[model samples]
Target chain A: MISRTFRRRVWLVLCALALGLAPFPVSAQQSVYIPITGAKKLRLALPDFKIGSADPAANSLAQTFDGVLWNDLYQSGLVEMVSKSFYPLQQPGTPTDLGGGALAAWSAAPTTAQRLVFGNVVVGNGALQVEGYLYDLTQPNKPFVLGKRYTDQPTPAAARVIAHEFADAIIAALGGGPGIAESKIVFISDRTGHKEVWMMDYDGANQQQLTHLDAICYSPRLSPDGSKVAFMELSSAGSRIRVLDLLTHRYARFPRLGGTNATPAWSPDGSKLAFSSSRTGDMEIYTINANGTGLRRLTYSPGVDIAPVWNPKTGAQIAFESDRTGLPQIYVMDADGTNQQRLTMSGYAVSPSWSPNGEALAFSWRRTGGGEGNGGAYDIYIWYLANRNYLQLTHNGERNDFPSWAPDGRHLVFAVGENESWQLFTILADGTSPAKLTTAGSNTMPNWSWH
Target chain B: MSHSRLRYLCTVMGAFAVMIALAGCRHKPAPAPPTPPPAPAPAPTITLNADPTSIQAGQSSTLTWSSQNATKVELNGASVDLNGSQSVSPTESTDYEAVAYGANGQTASASAHVTVTQPPPPPAPAPAPQPSIQDLWNQNIKDAYFDFDKSNIRPDAQEALQADAEFLKQHPDVDFIIEGHCDERGSAEYNMGLGDRRANAVKDYLVQLGVDGSRIRTISYGKEKPFCTEHTEACWQKNRVGHLVLATPAQ
Candidate 1:
């Protein structure tokens, strides 16, 4: 039990401490990826976007935009959302409304929001207008962190896109690398009675079938620029590598190297592809120009040398899976196939996906005896090239495989199998917050876009 | 014989009296030696016969044998009665032999030459229709299984490929496709690559065995269509194989 004056003094001291430690200068031009785990999560208020039009669809579209923006910011792991219950009866919808006592109300008392994201949506004559802003509330004079305008057709799709843009701006302003809001994930799904390639948003929305070949298709690797996707297709022509032009939505001509070609992976520059082909009576890694000419074999070993993934930072190095030592293990080599070195020493490791920074590799590994079907379970592991340290990203008994790194380098999307049903799941690189991305039919072999 | 003998007898009578006197002085001469017995018969004779004379694999044949004037009889180096019969099943063609020992230390042997031919396949049930090339292939060619994430032609796979090569060579006009499959493990893309390796391993082995390479084609169905659907090791093993199929015109 304390006196009212003593309690008031303690509260003042705590407020002073919070004000001293909370605010950091977040410039809009900084491009470095500040690790979310290291950066203090800022408290941000994301009030509902104000609807500025009488159009019947504007109400729902604004709601959709506001919801999507909030989710994106929350999922970025860079901010802690201030509950709506803490908001005052009147919330600012634009920079002009941040005048008077609005900033003081948001920065004080129960709201205590150090940052605020406010926007307004308008629909008129067939076009949608969105003006979004981010303000640093804790700073003197409440400086603007981000302010942008987006215009598109007044549709739900456009609303979601506009909201994603605003969230990306806020993320980039906070010292995170280019946000992954607009990124897409391509994977294989069997929902249509036949396995085919499918594409979905980074958050598992807008799932659309990309291929209707009605034959088994797998390993859809989107190009770095998101213009084309290279996949492995099995049909009457035998197993071959095919590319789908995402820009034109047509099948691009990829030369058929006879006798079983598979697992086409795009180089960082998207000018070439590396894949495994048996044309020489052995499965070896080969690279060909995007137009399918200038074919060159990069491996000549006797055993299988397959699943080649180019390092995203620099295309000079390639990592792949090889069973040359009698068991599948991850290996790295120069682009010319020289200086071949084994990265994994024991157990079965395959499906090597290089991290976006090229400093590490993520692969599916069964590290115990007896291989698959034995007691050992396949788990995702990240092998750091510089430190030679490995971090196990999953410990679940379910089969977690094909770990494709997200563009942010802080997350991975992999196929998780349980009870014979496979689904896609995204997990943080630090091995937290495993969120399932797909549920309809079995989905597998997910490849995250490189953008 | 009449005159000469009478004269010799008169002369001998005077000598005989002297000889008798000399014999009486010899004091009980040794008893006359007994006459020697006739020589024994020659070495023992043996006859061995296989009842059916020949048998296929998994079939049995009876070996009957008899020996005359022999102290001991043995069949195929194993001792047996002088006259006996036994059932023998030999996986390969063999010779059934019998050896006999005579009383006077002489040996004689005879071999029946069982000629264990592969038993004519269970008299092909009922109608006994002639088997087609497809049937022959289905009976002889076997799928080569792979270990988890392996593509090397195993020792057992080599044997299977040898038999497949023989069948392919016998039917030169028939072209075939090797469908490589994988278990429900690993990435589909990598498994595709693994399946490709497996199919290529089979084709390369067949080519090494003198099968024409141009007549062979390969495809990999990386865990897409599994031969066994269960999640057990045995089932996974069944799914991981290089299965040979008769190629259709479109393929």
Candidate 2:
């Protein structure tokens, strides 16, 4: 017979597991759970079309197709494309199997290929159609197919969209999710006269300006409700917290005391707002009714307090950045302004965002150098509130800031340096390779929408 | 003139009459040399000064005037009785004038501007010390931490609860509410429960410290409220804790 203690331990484990597996509302789900067990690795083959055929336009079309395909595959992060220079064809009929696979009917012609890629490009009536197939050297019987027909009658720009669609299709065929080629990323871009919020597809397409105010607006946070955006707007006098209704296109300022206010965070219920204010002569956390009444001061320290976030599990407490210890560190305090506690002991940390489960907080900690772009680099880190363990999520020497965790807590969206341009990037929670999600102007202050 | 003793006594009498007349004319001329007109006396000069020039409202000030042979003094357009000097206290600024009456009842006067400025009262000292939980909360307690989805006391939470325990032990009548809160990431319902757990945790810890558990009530605001609404983790961490509030006195 099992001991009573053993039975109790087993029961506790089961209960924890059940809590972890609780089902969320169907409408609240934004991500599809893809099982990795059925995922398979496949190869592709593309037919070689002459660089400049007798039909000059057809050859040009083939060259453009090759370039597009190469770039798409390189960015897909799913397959490794073998270099063409490794295999040389001495003659047209030379059997060139680079990976030692049996060459089929085309073995006579310089058919040196590992995983073969065969395609045909036809130009007809001002339209270009490219069809291709990818074959695995290990399994010659099955080949992955890919094709796209582009109509250039309207304009050459239309062809780019077609090419992107083909790339997405290839990604899906390879058992990867659809490439973010069509998805858009909304971020604050200062390319305009002022720092206005803008949106562009992940591939830098369809750039559109969202805010047109003369005042400086920064730290745009998308509402979990998906209907509004809350951001800090700065004027000559002080900062104003405002929310822009996406559907109505109307903006409302948060009623605040007499001082500069920044970092407006909406509670999970959307009934209250948490922000930092200097009304009492120093930066401190404050909460007010969402309609902007019933203001209550939450922190009363001589040190600078800022960057407040609410816990998802309990809205009664707030996490903020404070310099009470002579260094910027993370601190947790009661919602009513009592029971203040310091959470992080070292490093200059800011931008603390709670995960959906409230078990972890993701913040940017300055590395030894300094903050990125300021002669120092920073990385996104998650602090497990329960265990007091910190996990660094980025290794790049660039400045990464404003990390927002996805609803599932498996992925995080942050800003990373790309070619001297800061853009939005997403990475796994464990600090894996980052995928660029925005290609427009420098994008910062990314807040992921909640499911 | 006895007809100058009528003529005669003609010659001799006439001579006597002339002598008499001459004597009378001499005496008369001297007497009647019309009492010459008396010289005009000079005007008396009056100067005024007030002791305690600046006096508080409803206080009196002494108005002193110096006059050379002046008999009367007036203050603020009103007559003031004075022997040598006069005491006049006006609610507002005023001018004082003094006049002296000569023996013939003729008056010579001099005037001075006597301004009575009101003085300000002294500042009151600060109130004496009172028992306050604000001071205790601010000075003694550092901060409180909560477990994931829990408001209850974890080992880490004891450090802050201990401070509360000490504060209560020192003041037996003190009562407080443990307000629980959650971060902005979860649903409102989940956050409410989490906040409840946090408040209960602190209350339990206070109870363990020999404090009256009944004196401590728990209120879970849930994710409906937050201290910092920013998307940053710093804000979320701040939103997750148990707040201590002084209980309102019974009506």
| Candidate maximizing DockQ | 1
lDDT of 1 by residue, B103-176 (tens): 88899998987666654555655887889877887898899998877787889888888888888898999889
Query: TM-score, chain A, per candidate?
Result: 0.87, 0.61
The list of candidate 2 runs beyond 4 A from truth reads A1-179, A204-207, A224-227, A246-249, A252-257, A265-274, A279-305, A308-320, A331-343, A353-362, A367-375, A382-400, A404-443, A446-451, B1-251
Kindly list the per-residue Cα lDDT of model 2 for residues A113-228, writing each as its tens digit. Answer: 43555445556666666544545444455433443444553234444565566667766665555454443455777676576777554444566788999766667766667677
Backbone clash count, each prediction separately: 2, 77
- Please tell me the interface RMSD, in Å, for model 1: 2.3
TM-score of chain B of each: 0.48, 0.47
RMSD vs true structure, all candidates: 26.8, 20.2
* Position A449, candidate 1: lDDT: 91
Best by TM-score: 1
Q: Write the per-residue lDDT of candidate 1 for residues A1-451, one digit (tens) a residue.
A: 1112323443454465457742333223221111123334689999998888898889999998988898888777667899999997786778888787767888887998898888888999899999988888878474687889999999999999998888888988976677878889999999999989999998898999999999888788999898899988888678789899987889988887897787889999899999988888778999999999999999999877888999889999999998787668899999989999998777788889998888889999887553434545788987768746566778898777889998988778999887867899887676666878899999988999987
